[model samples]
Target: MTNRHQKYEVLDGLRGIAAISVMVMHFLQDLSVPVLQSAYLSVDIFFILSGFILTHSYGDKLHHALGIGQYLKMRLVRLYPMICIGLVIGAISLCAMKLDGAAAFSVGNFVSAVGENFLLLPYLGDMSVGSFIRTSAHGVPTLGNAGNFPLNPPEWSLFFEMFASLLFVAAIRFDRRSLLKAAYASLALFVVYGMMIGINEGKLTIIVNQGWRADNFVGGFFRVTYGFLIGVAIRKMLDSDGAPHAYWMSGRLIRSARALFVAFLLITLFPTSIKGLYPLAILVFVAPMLIFQGAKLRPGGALSARACSFVGWLSYPLYCVHYPVGRLVFTYLPNSEQHIVGAAALACGLSIAAAAVLAKCVEEPVRRYLMKRFAGAASRSAAPPVRAA
Candidate 1:
């Protein structure tokens, strides 16, 4: 294994760790345990990581030449397949809920809900079917808030993620010097916006918990901009001459790298039992440190390389599918603590398995098809003009 390929495996491992944390965190909702109290921070972590990976992968290539169409087509192929699958499964799960005695399970409502999910729109909106349900199974309304997907709640972040990716096309226009300056400017905007919201609303705006809210507009923007640009700044450093070697050490760095991710998993799975805006604290302080730490990871053994590669591949698929699968299990299967725990465990397993399936069956094939088209288009664009006699 080459050091080049290992560049972002640790980061990928963190993403996988976050995805599983979110899965368990949702399941633990039924049990009313606050384990993985800061697991919600995973969303912000993802926003930061997305910016890092996007810039790392495309910054140089796209900066020199703008290929917005192909760039976006690539993104769609990468992101939209699981979205489509989640929408379909969420629809089925919603219909299954109707059959299981939920009063809100009208076919008209089901169609509306599934349609919204397909658009990657927030399912917590006015037409949100999940919000109205009073199923006999849970007794309480199964939906938590209007901002989250009742059918597939975790996807709200992707709505923001997509928008952030689009913004990167604009970010590429600037050189590294200007990009960091822009990042700091956006960070200030984030701080100002967050403070205004917090002071006026008497609520913290930076932490992303509870699916969606109207007030989240400013806060969500800041959360993403700050995270995305900060990631770009980090990528700028990584892109600089002599960056990695300046920071690199030996195998102990590898263990430290692995331990950072282990800590993330442990924080997500276990009760920190710490109170007072710990999730916010993690977002404001700890998460960026993790990204920086992951950046410093050099290549280790073959096993380490392989593990990180798998982690990188699996992270996005796991994230995209977990919520719908978990929702299906919880809505249809059972509600008892023991049952929910088992269901949660089942969700974790099925998510891992389903992610592998999605990767092989959907992601890879679509990406190949899109890349082929993109190549053809680029070739045509690059072909020289012929002067005919």
Candidate 2:
């Protein structure tokens, strides 16, 4: 097993910031600022991070028996606890939203949704089964994810993460050549998909993010394919695509400081460009740059390092709990900007507290169990001891 010390401190901090960006973006977009409009790009950052971490950890070991199984277990242990909690919270909040008249309730779908919301596979069934975001002509709410009432909207990204991770395991078990081919093919598909979104919007664009629809969900697929493969490609290129080469990037054109700046800017600043092309710039350049630089980060001072670690530790559960926390609060509080500042602050605090609870009570324990029982077994199986003659 790789040492925990080897984990990238800067990337963890970036993820914490990104997770906060996502939550804040969701919270404030309706309240009028919308400065975090670009925060959705954080999804791409996550995809890149996933690919980088997965390849670094398992690229060479995937050919061994149990490697894939254990990898899946580790990922599931990390994901499922928070997912179940989010879904439960979402389901209960669905009733609350209905009472608040944010949505019209259906008993059958609610029961089914309570049962099926945890399905990790987006392709098997419609992800819109329980969505309740209102459809309106205005851009504000219209741009929202319109499925799965009170269910964590961001869970859709995790669905893509699961699918992409499965594909990554498959590629790793195959030869490097096959993985390269798959990456190229997926990239081609993403380009075609991006072009379609751009043409429809009259510029380079791709907007199907964290949404579930018959047609729009395809956008998420293309987005994931591009982001995840770029991650794999970057790691592979840094390693000279499996050939012998020095891993340090030449001349260090980009540094971890630049990475921190760019990632923060993407999440927090307004993109002063043709809006349609923003996602293109992020997916094509910025996200990958952040990952590359993040990989190269040297540990900073103790205070900064601890802050980064705390943010990283807070990120996952923060992400998992934010949407449901927002829903519950807004159900009782007004959804409009009537008390925008106070509303956002309250949602942020509640979400962070909920995340801390979940991380402490759920993810940590589940991960410890999986690590104790399966991590070693999986690692051992991947490089089984040779029997003596």
RMSD per model, one decimal:
6.7, 6.1
Candidate 1 per-residue lDDT over residues 212-251, each given as its tens digit: 4555554666677767876765667665632233234322
Compared with the true structure, what per-residue lDDT tens digits does model 2 show for residues 1-389? 33312656777778788899888887776644465877887888888777766776667667555556776776676677777787778767666665555555367656665565677544323223211222211123222323542366677788877887787875544444555567667666766765676577676554434334434567677677667776676666555544212224421555555446554665457644354455665666556766766666754677777877788888878888888777677657644336655777898999999889888987678766866676666654332211000
Query: What C-alpha lDDT, on a 0 to 100 scale, does residue 282 get in candidate 1?
Result: 62
Work out how many backbone clashes candidate 1 has. 4
Give the Å error, residue 45, model 1: 1.6
> Looking at model 2, how many pairs of residues clash?
5
lDDT of 1: 0.62
Worst 10 residues of 1 by lDDT: 380-389
Candidate 1 residue 303 C-alpha distance from true site, Å: 1.6
Model 1 misplacement above 4 A:
1-6, 63-66, 102-109, 127-143, 146-148, 175-181, 184-215, 241-255, 266-277, 334-338, 374-389
Model 1, residue 54: C-alpha shift (Å): 1.5
Give the Å error, residue 158, model 2: 0.6
- Cα distance off (Å), candidate 1, residue 365: 1.8
Candidate 2 local lDDT, residue 76? 74
What shift in Å separates residue 249 of candidate 2 from its native position after superposition?
8.1
